[model samples]
Target: MSDLPPENVQQYPRPPRIEPVPHLVVVRLGGETIAETTGAFRVLETHHAPSYYLPPEDVRARLDPVAGGSFCEWKGRARYFDVSAGGQRAPRAAWSYDAPSARFADLAGYLAFYAGLMEACFVGSERVIPQDGDFYGGWVTRNLTGRIKGARGTEHW
Candidate 1:
């Protein structure tokens, strides 16, 4: 509803693309503010909702490194984090790439949160919907078009 054009995830790039999010991004949980920033990046991939990444300096919650690790071809190796705020804990609810691929070098040390694990996440003034399923961490907001990944039948997508 803002002045931005609608994002069609189906048409997103295969290797993923990063772009600056010019809106205010905020993460809140258990009545406490987890992270807030006007400076954030959105990663868009095919058949997926955009994932917003915030800088470490903007995160106000506690992030404890966890054991699980994963590798993304475009983003490189990722490490998990257990986020704690307002006395509530969500295990491995966030992740960051300590060293990213050259294409995503700007994402180094940037934290991306699971909207489903938070009380609420906001992009600009709109509250976001968490993408379905447990396999993907995407934030769904208004003005996004096309079929999104992380849904029940989207496992292979």
Candidate 2:
């Protein structure tokens, strides 16, 4: 037998969905060609709707500035960032956690963009339709009122 220790074994959890799903797209200000992510990354994927989490290092830091903050019971406290482009600024369009809880630490310092604010947002070129209430920002297909509750379509967000 090999001398490798059992502790070195690495097993990846079966994701709800696999690659080539065409689930995410990145658009920068001034119609810039940003990175396009097709695969569902671990820290940002969800069954109902997948997400694209960009590390702070991947974003154009020159256009980003700490703007606000929020909290999540599951993920922990979050800090927000504003993107400035062409003299116009989108405040709190991105969010991250510098020190997330153990289970969520992989998301630390990684940025999640709110598609509702960007100039162009898409899931493989499929534009995001905004839901009712300007307070929340995500891909909105239809008026999901009674269909969704507590932000996640009933008991889940």
Off by over 4 Å in 1: 1-4
Q: What's the lDDT for all of these models?
A: 0.91, 0.50
TM-scores of the candidates are 0.95, 0.60
> Candidate 2's residue-wise lDDT over 1-157, tens digit each?
2121121101212232222333455556546534455432423223123334665555653346575677866568887778765455777777777887776666777666666667765554456554334443434323112232124443444
Error of 2 at 155 (Å): 11
Top candidate on lDDT is 1
Model 1 residue-pair collision total: 0
Per-residue lDDT of 46-95 in model 1, one digit per residue for the tens?
98889999999999998999997998877989999999989899999999
Runs off by more than 4 Å, candidate 2: 1-24, 38-51, 61-63, 141-146, 149-157
Q: How far is each candidate from the true structure, as Cα RMSD in Å?
A: 1.3, 10.8
Question: Cα deviation of 66 in candidate 2 (Å)?
Answer: 3.6
